[model samples]
Target: MNTPILLLQCLFLVLLSGPLFAQRWTTTSQESEQQPLRLHGSLLFQGIYPGFRVGVERPIRQTDFQRSNGRVNSHQRAVLFYVGMYYHPGFHLNTFAGAEYIFRRVGGRGLITEFRSSLALSRTFLGAETYRVGEAGIVETVLASGQFYAMPGLGFGMGKVLGKPGSNRPFAYMVNLNLTGLAPYNGLALPTPTLEIGFRYQLATTSVHFRHRIRTRQ
Candidate 1:
C-alpha cells in the first residue's frame, strides 16, 4: 500500500470513531469523582464486509459514577471515541469513526455487565467482481461502476468484562454481541448481528496511584 493510502486509512478511521470501545464494563463508587483514561482495542467480524476488522477506542471524559439499589455497589457511565479500519486489497477498503456510550453495573459474582451504543459514519470503496461466464468459461463479466457509497450507522450491544473482585485492572478480555443498522443503501438497511472480541486497559491510573501513595512516598 502507498503511504497516502495508509495515512488516509488511519485518518478516516480516526474521524469516524470520535474516540469511542473495545466496548467495556467498569464498576464505580460514588466517592470517586474522576475516573482514569482508558484504552480499548477490538477485532470485529460482521456480515456486511465479510472480514475481520480492528478498532482502537479511548475514553475522553472522566467516567460518571453513582451508587444504586441501596447496595455498596455503583453504576458507571463512559463516553469514548473510536477509529477503525478495513481493507481487502482488490475487494474493498473502509474507514470509520464513532462515539460510544457504556452504562455499566456489577453482575453476579463480580462480572461487569454493560449496555453499549454507538453512531458512526463510513466511506467505502468497492471493486467490481468479475464472474466466469457460461460453460467453457474463459470470458469474464464485470459489474460496471464499481460502487462508492457513504453510510451512517447506529448500533447497540450488550457486553461483559470478567474480573476478580477488588482488582483495579482485573479484566483483560471483553465479549460483546452487537446489532447494527446502516442506512441509505441497497434494500432496507436491516439490522445485522456481529460478535466482537476485544480488550481494555487503563492508560492513566490516577486512582491506583492514590492508593499506592505509601509505596510512592517510600
Candidate 2:
C-alpha cells in the first residue's frame, strides 16, 4: 500500500512541475487580436583587442660586416560591426543572421577590413534558482575571402518586465557577456581569442506607457 501511494505521489508531482515551470518562463500579450507584423532591425558595434606575434628580419651593416636582426611583439586594436534584422515567433526565436564588418591593425602600420556573414543560435538557461540565468550559443561566420568558420560561445543576460502605472505596456532591459570565435580559422591560419561586452535596450509600444506611469502616478 505504501509503495502504490509513493508511485501515485511521484506521478502527481511530475505532472504539476511542467506547467509551473512553463508559467515562470513565459508571458502572454493582452491584445485580444494580434497586431500587424512589423519588421525589426538592430545595429551592433564590437571592439576587439587582439595580440599577435610577428617575426621580422633586418640586414645590418657595421664595420664592413653584415648581420641579421629579429624581434617579436604583440599588436592590438581590432573592431567589428554588424547591422541586421531581428525576427521571431511571438518574440521567441533562437536564431539570428547578419552581416559583419571587421577592422584590424596589423604590424602597427597595416589595416585589414573583411566582410563576413554571421549566423547564431542563442538560448537562455535559467539556473537552479529562478533569478539566475545565463545565455549560450554557437555562431558560424563566413568571410568574403572564402573562409568558413564556427564558434561555440556563451553569455549572460538579465531582464525584467516594466509595467505602466496606469496603462498596459511592457518594457525590458538586458545586459550581455557576448563571446564569439571559439574555434580556429582555416584560410588565414589565424588562431586568436575574441571576447567583448554588450548592452541592449528593448523598445516596444510600452516605452510611452512607462513614461506615463512615472509622470501621472504617485
Candidate 3:
C-alpha cells in the first residue's frame, strides 16, 4: 500500500510539473546564462500525497572564478533551502536543505544537467486515531499524536534557464528523479523514487561577463 502510494505520488508529481517545465523550456534562450541566486516553486510527489514546494538557491562561492564562461561554466555550485506541502490522504509539510551540482550543459539554450542531495524533516497530522496505554491499575485511550519523519535524498535532473522577471537574467526549470528513504515510513522499509519538477528565478548574480572570448575573422 505504501509503495503504491509513493509511486502514484511520483507519477502525479510529474504530471503537475510537466506543464510548467514545458513553459519554461520554450522560453529558454542562448543569451541568458547562469545566475548566482535562484528562487523557485515546484510540485512534489513522493508519498501518498501530491505536494507543492518553493525554494531559494545561491552559489557556494560569491567570487568570480569563471566569469569568462561564455556558453557554459564548468564549476557551478549552490545550496538550496526549501519548504513544501502535501494535500492528500494525510496533510504533510516538509522542510529541507539541499546542495546542487551542475554537471553538464545540454545545449546552447541554457539547458543543463545536474545532481542534488537533500535532508528533510516532515510532519504529518493524523486525524482522529486511538491509542491504548495500560498502566498499573488503569487504561487510557489517547487520540492524535502526530508523526514525524526524516528523509535523506539524492536526485538527477535536467534544467533550462528561463528569462528573469523585469530583467532578462535567468530563470530555470528542472525535472528530477529523486530517491529517498524514510525511517519508519508508515510501516514501510525501502527507498522510494519521487519526481520533482520546478522553476527557479534568479535574484542576484556576481557577474555574467565572460572572462574569456574567442575571436575569429570570417
Candidate 4:
C-alpha cells in the first residue's frame, strides 16, 4: 500500500508540472507582444473566362446576324471590394465580394449580366510588414470556403516587395488567381477561372521621442 501511494503521488506531481513547463516553452518561443487591430480596404479588377460549358437553352439571336460562327464572346469583367482586419504581424482576416458583368448581345439589341460573390482568408508577409515602422517581412495568403453563384470555390494569392522599404511610406504589389463554379438556379454545375493583379501602398506616421536629462547642483 505504501509503494502504490508513493507512485500515485509522483505521477500527480508530474502531471501538474507538465502544463507549467509547456506554458513557459510556448511563451519563450514567440514574441509576447500583441499588435493592435487594424482596418484596411482594397479595390480589385479581374478578368474571367469560362472553362466549362455554360448552358444556354436558346441561341443568342444577335449571333445569328454575325458573319462569324454562332459562338459569342465569353470574356467578362469583374470588380471586387474587400475589407480586412490585421490580427497579427503575419496573419489577417478578410472578406471580399464582387460582380461580374457578362455581356452578350441578345436579339440583335440586348445584353445580359451575371454576378458573383466571394469570401476568403488573406495572409500577408513582406507587404504586411510595410505598415510597420521598421524592418521588412514577407506575406502569404490563402482563401477558402468561397461561394460563387451558390456554388463552392477556393483561391490562393501571394504578394512580394516592389521597392525599397521606407520610414514613412512603402509600396507593394500582388497577384491572385481564383477558381469558381457557375450554374443555373437548378441546373448542372460549371466552373470558371479568374486572374487579377493590383498594387498597394502603405503610409506610416512619424513619431518623435525625447529623452530627459538630469542636473546636480552644488
Best by TM-score: 3
Q: List the candidates' TM-scores in order.
A: 0.54, 0.26, 0.58, 0.29
Which 10-residue span in candidate 3 carries the lowest summed lDDT?
Answer: 209-218
RMSD of each: 15.5, 27.3, 13.0, 28.9
lDDT of the candidates, in the order given: 0.52, 0.27, 0.58, 0.33
Q: Give residue 202's error in model 4 in angstroms.
A: 4.1
Runs of candidate 2 with Cα error greater than 4 angstroms are 1-33, 36-146, 151-154, 160-171, 182-218
Give residue 48's lDDT in candidate 1 (0 to 100): 47
The TM-score measured for candidate 1 stands at 0.54
- 1-218 in candidate 2: lDDT tens per residue? 69999999999999999987645332222222221111222222233332111111111110110112221111212112232222222322122222232221111112212222233322322212222233555444322212233434333333222443211122322233344442344443222223322322233332111100011101
For 1-218, candidate 1 gives per-residue lDDT tens digits of 99999999999998767634211324332232334556777777664454343444333222322223322232455665776655556755555667777665544344566677776665555554656566776677755423333344444444444555422343545666766554545856635455667776666654321111000100
Output the number of the lDDT-best candidate.
Answer: 3
Cα-lDDT of candidate 4 = 0.33
Better of 2 and 3 by lDDT: 3
Q: How many residue pairs clash in all the candidates, one count each?
A: 12, 0, 4, 6
Q: Give every collision pair in model 4.
A: 124-139, 125-138, 125-139, 126-137, 126-138, 126-139
Question: What ranking emerges by lDDT with the best candidate at the front?
Answer: 3, 1, 4, 2
Q: How accurate is candidate 1 locally (lDDT)?
A: 0.52
Residue-wise C-alpha lDDT for candidate 4, range 40-90, written one tens digit per residue: 233333232111111111111111222133322221222233432222223
